[model samples]
Target: MPAKPRILFCHCNYARVVPDEVKSSVLEGLCKSGQAFDAVADLCEMAARRDPALKRLAAGESPVKIAACYPRAVKWLFGGCQAPLNAEHTEVVNMRELNAEDATNTVLNKTLTPNLPADGSVAKVEGEKKI
Candidate 1:
């Protein structure tokens, strides 16, 4: 690979729900859209996987760039990355918040924001970090 871009997905709670078919479709669309890398799924999976590669990227790369579908995803990878990565590169797509599901409209609206502590700690509901 020719210097692959470092893509991270922060606080992607819907990872389990994001159907593989949708993922493939989005990736195909992205490939057609432009020259953007097809590392979206990998990045998201890595974040979910809590891979050390994220920290390595922050340590080695300059102008460490990331294109996330969610800003919380950035925050998720931020502390673990071991460097002060820019917040700008992170993008937050309000799927649960903005997409506005009609079925759970009442419940979702009340719980839109990311589940975070006041001290900025990710309230670990699931998944364990691999040592």
Candidate 2:
């Protein structure tokens, strides 16, 4: 079996779009589901500062799924980091608009399924059509 993608949940410390209780609920659900993940206070700032943890995450070959705000904002935040994250190998979940249950469901569905495109390309799970 392929390795499971790492799930990263952003608390959006500064913006405060995703509430702390929501984040906690999602994290607890993920843990109970046997999915491994990391909860970060602020992914944008971490990427901006080139934090070592971010570097380590970037260096990994496994795909990554980020649960945060808008997809565009996540992309912009990671843009300045030293290590490059190929767009194909990443996925973003819009936690800003989703409740804790919905966010957890999205993360679990993406990480636990064999949803990658047959062409060996990266795809984003946004709506009905995978991007």
Estimated TM-score per prediction?
0.41, 0.70
- Best-fitting candidate, measured by TM-score? 2
Worst 10 residues of 1 by lDDT: 103-112
Question: lDDT: which candidate is best?
Answer: 2
Pairs with steric clashes in candidate 2? none
Could you tell me the TM-score of candidate 2? 0.70
* Native-to-model Cα distance after best TM-score fit, residue 116 in candidate 2, in Å: 14
Off by over 4 Å in 2: 110-131
Cα error of candidate 1 at position 130, Å: 8.4
lDDT of 1 by residue, 12-35 (tens): 334554444434443444445443
lDDT of 2 by residue, 12-94 (tens): 78876677766777778877987668888889778666566865665677888877777766665555454455566777777
How high is the lDDT of residue 79 in model 1? Answer: 54
List the global CA lDDT of all models: 0.39, 0.68
